[model samples]
Target: MNTTKLAGNFLLPISLLIFSLTAFSCSADLEDKVVGNWQGYDFLFQKTEGPDIVVTINGGLEQHLRSKLILSDNGTFQKLVGEYDNGKGTWVVEEDKLITTNENGEKLIYTLLKVTDKELMTLHEVDLKTPDGTLKGKIILSYTR
Candidate 1:
């Protein structure tokens, strides 16, 4: 094969690889956009029960605790919920998930629903034991800067 033809064939693949890497790197930048203080405005917990496990929403005035999450540019974070303070620790973003580990080596993960300069929303699922059986629920958190 001629040298020019051989080089042309390699160029397309190289260009595609570069483009793919650029796109992947941009996705990772989403973490940087989330580095700031976020004040929790709404925290809704939906609990399910009975044979069908129907979900019921309990929030608004029922939630008395104030909460906040502060994320530093250095990959460290602190979470404050009411009077309880979850010790600071390291945090990272993997795809659409935010994974955080506390000072006590406890790990918590939240699914990123939406994040912007002004607002952030996340969802977390929890299983709790009830008198009847195991109940599945979700805690949805809405925050603002």
Candidate 2:
């Protein structure tokens, strides 16, 4: 067995192990691109319940509360509406989805549409139970950094 050939064979596995460890630390939880401060841009509410008619419902309960949305690298988030505040929650990116769990234990799953260094837009499907009945719809929140 040639000594140089044996040494070279051991080097390949060692080099791959080092590369894999570095890659793992760099992408821990996959939240790198979304950890930043975002400003509220615009929002749209759509009701997707009816058979033929699609109506835009208005009012508030996750309304267009506009201001600052801060997504920390530590996996926590805060949304400020005006000065009083809107809500605070923990957020994580699961594949292409942004999952947020509010303080009230309400979990809202949002489909990550477009996330960039400048803008972040998400679509959230929600079911609200009121005195009348259940309202099924989706909300799109657009934000810019």
Give all candidates' CA lDDT scores: 0.66, 0.65
> After best superposition, candidate 1 residue 29: deviation in angstroms?
2.2
Clashing residue pairs for model 2: none
Clashes of 2: 0
lDDT by residue (tens digit), candidate 2, 1-145: 4332343455446434533443342223446877899887766555545321223243432345457888998889987876767789898887666888989988878766556678777767767766556766666677898
Off by over 4 Å in 2: 1-30, 50-56, 60-65
Candidate no. 1 TM-score = 0.65
Reference-based TM-score, model 2: 0.66
lDDT of 1 at 92: 93
Q: Residue by residue across 23-109, what tens digits does model 1's lDDT show?
A: 343437769878999888866454433233323223331342377789998999987767577578999988867888998888888
How many clashes in each structure?
0, 0
CA lDDT of 85 in candidate 1? 79
Predicted structure 1: lDDT: 0.66
